[model samples]
Target: MSQNDNNTDQKKSESHALVKSDENGHALTVKGKGRLLALTDSILKSAIASRKANQLAVDDSWMQEIWNWADSFTISEKKIPRNRQMLLGLTELDISGNLLEILPESIGNLTNLTELNLQQNMLSELPESIGNLTNLTKLNLQNNRLSELPESIGNLTNLTELSLRDNRLSELPESIGNLTNLTELSLRDNRLSELPESIGNLTNLTSLDIFGVRLSELPESIGNLTNLTELNLDYNNLSELPESIGQLNNLTRLDLSRNELSKLPESIGNLTNLIELDLSSNNNLSELPESIGNLTNLIVLDLSSNNKLSELPESIGNLTNLTELNLYNNRLNELPESISNLTNLIKLSLHGNKLSKLPENIGHLTNLTELDLWSHNLSELPESIGSLTNLTELNLGYNGLSELPESIGNLTNLTVLDLSNNELSKLPESIGNLTNLDSLSLHGNNLSELPESIGNLTNLIELFLSRNELSKLPESIGNLTNLIELFLSSNKLSELPESIGQLKNLTRLDLRNTMVRELPTSINQNRVKVIL
Candidate 1:
């Protein structure tokens, strides 16, 4: 018989045998928990030795020590688990945070145990006999020094959730494939560079996490996990995915962020059930598959930090159900007119891109409530944008816009508007129509004056107009009775506007390094902190 055959049979024998000791100085076999506890070590060892070929049990002393430990089981809450067999039939044990270094091999005596938690330990290895716990349904060995797993781990075929997160495991044993019933497995923050092809055998797996590994590629066999609903492979060195990945039709959420992937297989579009897909920080990704539009069920798509991407496919417009799309930190120079098809979009992030213009019909997304276009090269906004009556926040900072369309004041629902760091030299008197505006930022521009209409923002709470060419603040600024913080430093101001004292809610006022020569007497009665 092969050595492998011997080991297999050995495991089989131990599971069925009931041990005991006889009077002949030789151990005997008897059933039941019959206080076999009193059996002498030499007697038990002798009996174990007489057994035929299979190496059934370990040293008698070792077995006794395990039985003793089992009898010692008690919860640290200074209480025992409230089970009828609290002392004899422990089905669950959590000795986590105990700082144990070496787990005894005799732990396998727990044949009836269903759960074992040894998380947060300094243990560097698990005893080979650990596999004898055939009934274990959950095991948490996270945050340990386990550099390797025992091959017998395959014996715990009933484990549904196994977490080895934050461990030192460099690779999983090929025998892990025997756990066909596992549903969730976490190997995050490990040194694993590759997974065994046998992992594909986990057809029942629903979630698999391998984030923070050094894996550069996925095994092609990974596609066999058709029942998976969520998969996280973020922060790995993966530069490509297997074409077979499209087989995960049940997958609803997938994260492949922070990898080296330059392109994705077109098969990715086959995940019609995918609702959320994050491909952020893949620096080499230059474009997405045109088939990406096939994800009509998608609600969120994040492609941020892929700076090499210069454009998106027109087919992207097909994600009509998408509520959020993040394209931050890319090199996109133009937007597809098809974006108008995403009328359900609520939040759109396009910051740090090279976009010179926006889709003229972007207002078609009237459902949008937040729009982030900061740090782009946009010189102007299309007048059609005002059609987004639901917009509450608009960010156009660090752009080269010379002016805003007068239609901007039409977004009466806007609460936060940022137009700082632009080339604007003037504001249309119609700007004051934003009566619902709560905060406005227009600093670092060429504006020499404010339209008296600025007072129309009756709800304005915070206002920033620093570092501009402003020679004076519009008296309407004092009408912002809800103001709390006002920054107006480094401007060409010559004197304080008496209306400023009318700001009853203003708490902080900055006026350093400006041309202001004097203060209005009302400023004293208003108790405003003056920074001359």
Candidate 2:
């Protein structure tokens, strides 16, 4: 053989040594050989180091692809690529609000991740390999299309917070109970009909939100979560609660509003630690258990819109710590005298009820800032109302009151007062004593003339006296320099008060259907829009 032929043979031998083939005899390229050698070298180095080093040998091609995708992704004005480094060392990843539809199974290679947020995505399923992330402590998958979670998720025993809210999940895997360290879990706005019994295993849970789910009842196992401090089960189909619910004595806040519940379990009283309780909008609820009085620590209690609620248990007076009490739209005709014991109440709303009179001791609520008794059968108000010196807002509209008590002026702190649609023919001069008033509505009444004291409300921004029988406005009305809107429509006024020109801040003066035919030159010169 010639020298050239010998050189060619040597090169062929080198090439053959670098490449290999399968049993089928298809040759592997030199590039493939290089990759294989690199993988082998990594594995050998990992074996020589420690078990944790084995993770460093994982194929990083998948991560490289993810990095490439992240290059173009943005969330909340943050670029995900900015956090990237060597893939194996990644401990936290946030790709939320990216509209991502798939999560590659190779993601499990990121075993070092402790926090993963994929919320507000379109992902329909998670890879079972997710279980490989045993170090994960927080996982957020809210607002996704997930119909179910992989059982392997239970392997994340270190997880403390998991939010699967706004998903399509109808059921959870029993393995979920394995996450014993979980402290907060949110499944709000999902399609879940019931929770797995295994949920009780999460005794470390401090907060659990299952709002807007279709659950007709909660599992008895839920009672096992004695450490829970906040539990929200609003907007469900629950008609009754399991007695086991009383076991969660640590709960500080409980929301059971907008459900089909007709009665609450008497055991509910056991949650004495509760600071807020909402049981509103349960149309079937006619009476509350006397045990409700046991929640003495409550600061807010909402029992509104229960149409059949005709009376409250006198025990309600036991919640003296309450600051807000909403009992609007009920069938109650009279309030229990015990209600006066809620001396700490700041807001009391009883509108849309059949109440004809208020307790004479209502003045006991010295801290009251707002009182609403609209749409009731009240023909008169108790003189004791004058004692609510701290009152800022008072609504007695749509009542049968023919006159206000002369002591009404005692509410000097009043900023808004609505007494519309009443039988009042005249307002007490005391009405003017509310000098702090910014808005006063007295329309839809039988008033024939103005109270000169009305002019004393110099702070008034809006004065509504429409749909009344007023024949003339007091000249003192011009003293309201801060008035922005003056509604005098459907009244018998024949002409504008020359003092009206003094309202420099007036923007709208509605005089439609009034006897006035000409505009005040002062109003014509200003920017006021007069609606005739």
Candidate 3:
């Protein structure tokens, strides 16, 4: 049987044997035997009914033990009534994962209770008496049917954390502001359309999560939470924020993605302590306030999928501490030369933009580790690009490039280089200098021949040169002993160098649509899978 079933059966056996019919009659045995009272009012009421039926007789001593055991209680998976007497000194109560529909007003009588978990229950409302537990520090009512909290909840002055997530709560009582000591509050996945201005009274709050809701606007008073360090309000319908948000000078992380924000207040720059900001997927936002540059401490910033953003403020370069910046899927036509000021940038994405060219000083970003400029109208890369020696991945595919700078070979750190679907007729012999290259793609080009120097990329694992006018591959191709997949289909080649057979590590080679009539005898002798 399942462990849960065994425990349930054992609990039933223990409850039935609590009062033996022997001469002992309702004996309260606290010996090596099972528990004499293992449940709360749910089972205790059944015990009482049994006693009244003359099946078992309980004395005052037995009743005392029942009351004490109720201090730490549970009514889980049982049908119980709200009128059950409250255990006055109860310190902990767990009625979670139950069918409870209501909490009795007598719960307040348990003034000593410090923690209460009522998650995963059918509770639609809580008794106002709950506020009487002034000593309570933690309360979890998540995954319930509660549409509102009792106004008296503010009376639990000592509460540190309150979670009402995944509930039907539409609004919070103004008295909730009385929770002066609360530090964490989560109301995510609710239909809360607005917050009470009194929410600002929570001066001690450090973390607040109201995401997955349709809150169109936050109360201006929310800025009063000076102690807040993290605020997540994503996936909401918020179109604008109050200027008072700048008051959160202590905030370090802010997420406002997936919102309907069309603009931001200049006060946004006031978050000087902010380290990470996400404004992605907010298609309605066309531009960011210049004040954004004020987040000098920011390390990561995402502004992708803002189609109307035609340009970025030059002040963005002021974020010298930025390590990752994403501006993909926008209508940007040009990047400010100031972008070179982000010397600490490790990754930058400018894909799917309307840019015809990049800033001449683009090469000034020496710390870039990954640069993606796919699907642009660029004609050529600046010679300065060779200065990005730290670049490990570079994507310049689907562009109008016809030639590359010889300096490109200076990026010896490149592991994956994509130059497909371009107008290039030939590559600079300097391409052979990328000894550390792992994947090289030069497909869909006008190339008529590859420089013999191409063979210098001995570390290449994947080489795609399909749809080219090449008549023959440089014999040096055989030098890539580590090559695994090679695509040379749709070429004019009639023969391959005998050295091709030396690539023992090659598993797949494609030569379809080519003029090749026969494979090298050596290739036919190896385990390589040739595809024609």
Candidate 4:
């Protein structure tokens, strides 16, 4: 028609115009035809109306939250909860995989809920509409079946993180001082008894685990939390403590081990940033608070099974950066040479004490590496304990020592040397110069013999000279060869030194009440087990 109808309408407007190809670039993955299929059908109808407006704003923020016990089989029902008032656009709710046992009353219409996760539920009681959430701030009722907990939960008042771990709560709601913006409060394995003075008003708690609760007392307003830093009342039933717990003062790890505490308040040395202090199995403690040497930033101090301690306060050598000092089953007979001022002690446990002697400044600690004076009542030892030399574990078992101080061959970094039930007849041939001895206990000793320099220990492995009074032994104790448990029981040793069949890692060879009636046919006798 006029230029062939405008050249066919300019080739149908260049086939719908949105073209590509400016060089070798070919991503015009031409799907439909020209004009880019009407601009890809108007951009797929505006991306389906922007994905239905983001799923209608996530279903209107989960239908204004609040009590949404979205079920999954948490134990069936107990009903009652329903969305009350416009639930203040409830904050977060999931009533956790439920089986509800109670806790409904429409949680007082979510007073602007903050965060409430009812973990694995089957709740046993709680809803006083949880005192209207009051803007809760993280409250997870972990593994529930709660055995009670609602003094209207002290009206939430902006909680800061409270998890009632594994519940069966025995009692708590002293209006938990109304949450007071808590900060990590877990009642581990609950059965809690007493703890209400409004939980000392939280005072901005900082980690407080009530492990295995049965708590006997603590409400001296727990010194108002004072910003705690790790406080676990382990195995509770506390016998005493309210010295306003030295007002917390930013404590750092305090586990009152198996409680029934026998005493401790010298204002507990005012915490002084304590670092791990566990009063192990309190056994009616016999005493211990010379202001705990003011905690000198303690580092692991566990007074093990307090067996009526008999001594230890020279301000316990002022701790001096103590590193693991557990006084096991005590009744101490001696030790405080101010423990030679600890000298950066490294694991020193005086097991079952009744000590006979030790303070020759016990070789000034020398950065000791595990030294347990087992059973104690020692008969001798202080040759300045052979200058520790970073000893690697040395337990002087059930003492009454017969002899040893040849400056124990300067401990050549001993590797476990437990001189079992002592009365040792003799040993210091410079203890075969240790050579990293690997476990050597002269069990119930009185050794009749054993020194060809014990064939230089050769990294001996578990060689306990059973109930000894040995009649004879040195063939260099058969060159150890990494022996494993070679106890010569009640020895009177009748015979058997064919180099004790050159032990090939003998696994237990106790010549019971020995007069060794036999054994030595190249002693493997089926991987040895000779208990007689």
> By lDDT, who's the top model here?
2
Q: Model 4 clash pairs? A: 15-35, 16-35, 74-98, 74-99, 75-99, 177-198
Q: Residues 27-143, candidate 4, lDDT per residue (tens digit)?
A: 454433545777678668877998999987664454433225434333222332333333446577666765566654655655676887887867877767777767778989978
lDDT of 2: 0.91
Instruction: Quote each prediction's TM-score.
Output: 0.86, 0.87, 0.80, 0.34
| lDDT accuracy of residue 488 in candidate 4 | 79
lDDT agreement with native, every candidate: 0.88, 0.91, 0.87, 0.80
Error of 4 at 296 (Å): 6.7
Candidate 4 or 3, higher lDDT: 3
TM-score of decoy 4: 0.34
- Model 1 residue 348 CA deviation in Å: 0.7
Residue-wise C-alpha lDDT for candidate 2, range 420-453, written one tens digit per residue: 9999999999988999999999999999998888
Which regions of candidate 1 are displaced past 4 Å? 1-85, 525-527
| Poorly placed runs, candidate 2 (over 4 Å) | 1-85
Report the Cα lDDT for candidate 4.
0.80
Q: After superposition, how far is residue 523 of candidate 3 from its true place, in Å?
A: 2.4
lDDT of 3 by residue, 428-513 (tens): 98999888999999999999999999999999999999999999988888999999999999999999999999898999999999
Candidate order by TM-score, decreasing, is 2, 1, 3, 4
**Candidate 1's residue-wise lDDT over 403-467, tens digit each?**
98988988989999999999999987778988898889999999998998998888999999998
